[model samples]
Target: MDMLHFGGLAVLLALCAMASNMIYNHFYEMVEHHYGWQRTVRMRVVHTLGFEAFFMAIALPLTAWWLSISVVEALLLDVTFSIFFMIYAFCFNWVFDIARHRLAARVVADR
Candidate 1:
């Protein structure tokens, strides 16, 4: 594919990622609230696994169809991406939670 095609694909993936993040967080937070589950290590691990699994389910088939690759190949690629995203999601969520807490604190302090 050309650079333009790759660029478009990247944009689509990014949009999908954003949408998934929003949807995942909504439901995840609901569960946390219902269960009173804190963001402990166990909850983080569950979050990472659930998020990646949800993403892979949507992405793997799209990737195979888009790239004209076999299911096995797509699964392999998805696994590779999953490994990266696992660490990335863990760190990203950790940092985001910290930043959000700080912002909320500032807002409350200013009130």
Candidate 2:
């Protein structure tokens, strides 16, 4: 296929990924609140790291083969995104935990 087709398809795929992630944030918050999984700082850290590694493992080979790029290059890019998301996830989950607790406490107090 032509570069134009490849580029367009990549853009479309990225848009879909963005949409999925947006939807997932709601479920992630719900899981944290319902299960208390991310209530502790330590669990949040581990969860973020595991998430990053999981995404890296899934993305590296598929991206390399599909883009016709070197495996090493794809791995490097994947790692970069993984690291960024790891830190982001940790911070976001931490804040979400605090918010979840406060909201829960408020609800209990109201009743």
Candidate 3:
């Protein structure tokens, strides 16, 4: 395989991962909020870790074969995904909380 091909595949995979993470984070927040599970942040973290592992295992192997790379290389790519997910989950939730608070306060002031 050409070096450029690998680089292109890597960039494509990263973009897809980012899009999926955004979707998943929104879903996770909805589920947690609807169920009033804020007290179970630890459970959420654990669930996210398991979710990341499950996805990486399946995706990494297929990516490795498609990209003609080693499994280790694929796992390295996936580890990057895992870290992205972990950080995104925490930071998005934090920012979301702040935004929600501001919205609520504005509503109160308007009324």
Highest-TM-score candidate = 1
lDDT tens per residue, model 3, 10-104 = 77667766666666667766786898876346765665675576557556877898878899998886677679877786566567667888999
Residue-level lDDT tens digits of model 1 in 66-109 = 77888689898677777988999999888888899899999999
Give the root-mean-square deviation of each candidate in angstroms.
Answer: 1.9, 4.6, 3.6
* Highest-scoring model, lDDT: 1
- The lDDT values for all models are 0.84, 0.69, 0.71
Q: What is the model-wide C-alpha lDDT for candidate 1? A: 0.84
Q: What TM-score would every model get versus the actual structure?
A: 0.84, 0.65, 0.59
The backbone clash count of each candidate, in order, is: 0, 0, 0
Backbone clash tally for model 2?
Answer: 0
Residue 54 of model 3 has an lDDT of 51
12-98, model 2: which lDDT tens digit per residue?
546644664565566665777798663567767766665555555556666777778887998876676667767877887789778
Candidate 1: where are CA atoms >4 Å away? 109-111
Two-way TM-score contest, 2 vs 3, winner: 2
lDDT of 2: 0.69
Candidate 3 regions with alpha-carbon error over 4 angstroms = 1-3, 26-30, 39-51, 54-58, 70-73
Model 2 — TM-score against the truth? 0.65
